[model samples]
Target: MRAGRGLLAALALVLAAPGGLAAADPAAEARAAAESLRAAGNLLSGAEEAKDRVAALTETVRAYEAGLASLRAGLRRATIRERAIARGLEARRQELGQLLGVMLGMERTPEALLLLHPSGPVGTARAGMMLGTVTPALQAEAEILRAELEEIATLRALQEAAAGALADGLAGVQTARTALSQAVAERRELPRRFAASPDALKSLLENSDTLDSFAAGLARDSGQGPAEPGYALPPLPLPVNGTLLRGYGETDAAGISRPGVVLATRPLALVTAPAPATILYRGPLLDYGNVIVLEPAPGILMVFAGLAEVYGATGEVVPAGSPVGLMGGAAPDAAAFLKAATEGGGSSQPETLYIEVREGDTPVDPAGLFELDKD
Candidate 1:
């Protein structure tokens, strides 16, 4: 019966041993969440070129919210794991203290002294049995102590990892918050398109059936006034330096066809005017996020979208290489996204900007206009 109890106790210890069982990795999950957010950012970059700025903004906000949610979930998991480990550690500490106390008592009252101090044969026999029982119990406890020590070490390492994950999650949330704030501020700064009255422009925008109609309306309004002198198309520069994610007419992962080129740039990349141009419009349009439309010549127009902050305004003329806006950074859950992308045989996704060129109402290839070798 005693042996059966001992076997059961050993089985229980094996089952309860720290780091002995398979468990979810909170750090890995957090990294995965980050990677997903990066993918969303890539899609948002393409969405910026969509004719509807409102839809693009909505998508962008959704991505940010999703990223935040993922980070929060990871953080919660880490917190729970940390607490569980801490509780186990505390119980182990108490067990260790008791074991140490028993060891000390045995050391002070040596077996040799016990044998020497026996009162009679009857007492000696009882003492002998006590010594036999105490010896095996001490050895068993010593083995348990060793296992507990290892378990404690494992728990400490896990706690440290959980703490690191929590810190990373908090940092990612802050970055997302800052990016969102900048986007909102830029949207608020855009001037009303129609000069006559804000209500008239709002009404026109509401009544417009399509994006092309809206574009045509703006062009007609600009043409109604005195004609601006046509300027030559100078050697244009790329707005921001980065990898070309997708070219004009290419379909993105979301299956949406892009009308312009998408550049995957570093976080907070500076977006500049490609050529000397007057800003025709600078604001959020229906699906494009924070758009900046520039008229470089009488018939040619350049559009930049997916900006977190815009520097120029409507009717403001800027020279080539002049700062127009800044690209947004990755959402807070970026770490996971980068890791997953790298592991999946792809590079990390970064802030994306969309560039589009047009001649009148027809879209033109942006590739031919920019001097790619110059920069």
Candidate 2:
């Protein structure tokens, strides 16, 4: 019978685990909350930057179109060099015809005759000298043809180059425009999701209300400090290894910034519920994908995002180390995150785990409270 009572007590303890854990440092929690805000802010900033780039691309496309139009206009006009070459070639042909008349001993000899009988009468030194004299005129005609051909080639090359540049510029403009349009659409949608986010945040802040209210009762019973350390509380274990890609705090990405850490984790690593608590909400958020919120204390809310699955429902309590959801099945996983550390070599993995602690509805760094494994 005593053993049965002990088993019952154990079960109750398991059920009561939500209130039992979390003897952590408030400062660390604050930092975690702050980091969450920062991450959201960064994402919002990125979205704005994408919009700005779209504007720049639009301007560039306009400039490219203007340049293409100008090039087409220039191609229509004949250059002075081309006209000179045409005239020179015609004069050479006439001169050759006159020379042929002198050689053929006829009053009117065609230009073709001079070429055919370039040496006039062979087997004589005078024939060789006459061939040399006509050679210069023929060479001059060849030069004219070559010059005219070169002018046409230059114009064609410029036109081809300009066409390619315009094509590339237009493609860039279109891509940027699409991205900007997407940003605007998302910006409009996020407020509704974030509206509940503040409620969750409010719940977290209210957890501290116990500190002030229960402080009096606890002090009357047993003397206690005004603020107790949260370090002794259970640590929120990470489902996967990764670095803090974006710290908690106001960060910009899609359109608005919200509270949370953007962890660069293994692509598809499972994200589990940190502790046993009643799930307050579960659904898709604006920027956060497949989010789940849990209320551990009266006002202490834990928000989890970038999930593939939601194990528990709102008002359902979960245990510590519970598998809330697995990362990456059809969608990309937050587990596999890569940070850009170097310009050429690329980013390196961090040794420490990525976690954010929040207390009194504010963000704090999680590193201070937990004893991180160096290995």
Candidate 3:
């Protein structure tokens, strides 16, 4: 009976008191993320000459971005689990000492007596009876502890491996972005719209004080795009891979609300055209930062702001998924990335891309116009 109690105590000492096994397999998720990276690497191996090089590299860059995001998420999960287990062990340090004592006592006692627990004839019978129930539980809990420790080790190994892969990923995406930019610059096959009138655009840039005013000017131009009045927008991808920072009508830290959705994009991320659109204007505009104004259909104009570099000339009709610009900011290198992952919080997306849609002259919410990406 006493031995049984000791075993249970030992089990209690090692057993984590918080949540049980996580419902999702973060390791599996990490592996899936790695697979995505591998795919990107394979596609980019000789991507410069692929017939659809521009499109291929575009997808490649996006794949790398999405994969890296997934990897970050997985690393964060693994780190959090490892820390929780460590905290559990640290909290029960004294209990663990007692557990050692129990284990040592078990070693000294006779095997038959260990099971029988010689309290007395009546108590002995009861201990033997309890043994049947208790032994399996002790083994089970010990196995659980072993598994948890192994999980910590696996997580640590994963983070270390991710460092090299993440560095390579960062470099790879940058290379792809550079290639995509050149490809877009050389591209001349896209259909054309009327060239932006420099004097008119220049006047608008100088006179317009707000994004709304600038957008309204560029959109009202008759030759900006094919006039299809009351065009119902189909769900299209957001210009960049990102998470939603602020939705339309959401107030920010400054307590200002806008009729636009703010997306938090990774540094130097590529921004692609969501659909076929004619570039009405592409340059630094008002307070919105580097902006690309596209009239997808007459009466519907989309504005992408906060870019580091803009591609294509005004009046170039770009197809869906065409590279239009790059997001502003600098990404962390591998060392910093791994350090952040090991530290167990998460990575930061420093660049903000503000997207707004105007239907005719009215500023409308853009959230439903684009399919939002969670990663």
Best by TM-score: 3
C-alpha local distance difference test of each model: 0.58, 0.40, 0.78
Per-residue lDDT tens digits for candidate 2, residues 1-375, read: 222233333333322222111212322232233333333333334544554433333333333323322322232232233344445545555654554344334223343453354454553456446656755654454344444445544533443344443344334334433443343233321112112344544444354343223223222222112224453346665544444565555464655443445565433344555565555556554435676665444444455666654544444555555445434433111121101100113233322222444443444454443333422
Q: Is 2 or 3 the stronger prediction by TM-score?
A: 3
TM-score of candidate 1 to 2 decimals: 0.42
Q: For candidate 2, report its TM-score.
A: 0.30
Quote the positional error of residue 344 for candidate 1 in Å: 11
- Top candidate by lDDT: 3
How displaced is residue 40 in candidate 3, in Å? Answer: 0.9
- Give lDDT: candidate 1, residue 106: 49
C-alpha TM-score for every candidate: 0.42, 0.30, 0.87
Q: Report the alpha-carbon TM-score of model 3 versus the true structure.
A: 0.87
Cα displacement (Å) at residue 199, model 1: 4.1
